[model samples]
Target: MFKKFLAIFTLTFSLINVALADQANPQVVMKTNLGDIKLELYPEKAPITVKNFLDYVDNGFYEGTIFHRTIAGFMIQGGGFTQDLERKEVRDPIKNESANGLSNLQGTISMARTNFPDSATSQFFINAVNNYNLDARGRRPGYAVFGKVTDGLDLVVRISRSPTAPKGGHRNVPQQAVIIEKIERLGSESKAN
Candidate 1:
């Protein structure tokens, strides 16, 4: 009887481990001119936003895009423009998922949107510092926080600190473009912290 119980316990433990591993968050590696940044998205919290972002990634929409806006100590916005500051055409806007209970903490990635609240399309931003105002509250529609940077945060800092200047009526545009070479989804080896 004792031997049987031990075997059952061991099997249960192993199964639990496998189940946890199988549920690992979806991760993507973004190779940029500055460096590589690994992001882990929370599909459980913001399913719609994650689906939209993953669609963009799978479609190669972020490739060759430049970090069009950078505000030191604030956030870095990208995935919308080219090296020459030309805005790329994006898919239809997604529904606002800001009520998903995620916060805009430092290193968290959120969808960039217009004042319309549901205007987030292809543009996204990474928070350099905690941005509580971007989190939804009551009836206020805030930016949808879907993911966070799990690696290469230093590269984000460097890009955030890059000098900025007015370009084509846009302020805080990085004088030296920080281009996104590619963004690809990672396999099972990828894990989000």
Candidate 2:
């Protein structure tokens, strides 16, 4: 009877640990027409940015969005415009978290903002190559790096390589819009190994 009780306690402890581990750093899966892009967000590093992004995902704000801008060898930007070039309303811009010690390296995802440093809303970009210029340094306010693509990087490349043209005064718009089907928080079991 003592052995049985010990086994039950051990199993319960293991399950609780797993749940806590998954909650610490969340994972998200972004399904696009091109392919599935899995991301591992760093809430510990960029807490505000990660929270904003996850809130957007949870609210279904990324559904039916398109990759509006894709610059080969640079990055692919999306999560703001629709397939018909219509801009969607987003929450107020969050504070700049560029000094979070995260670099805009290849496969890393960063927020896309206007000239204002703290004007990042729902738009984000995935770096196709090392983009050191986007990293905060000295007095420069660089884009905030919050997460990275753990899978479907080749799909990101494919979308970046797609034909682009000017549309609705927006340059580098993909001719064939790569629509974002949906983005959701990945289950703990689905996290990247």
For model 2, how does the per-residue alpha-carbon lDDT over 6-102 read when each residue is reduced to its tens digit? Answer: 9999999999998786566788899987789999899888999999998888888999999999999999999999888899999999999999999
Candidates' lDDT values, in order?
0.91, 0.91
lDDT, candidate 1, 79-182, per-residue tens:
99989888999999999999998899999999999999989999999999999988999999999999999998888888899999999989999999899998
Instruction: Return the top candidate by lDDT.
Output: 2
For residue 192, give model 2's deviation from the true position in Å.
Answer: 21
- Candidate 2: stretches off by over 4 Å: 1-23, 188-193
Best by TM-score: 1
TM-score of each predicted structure versus truth: 0.87, 0.85
- What lDDT does model 1 reach? 0.91
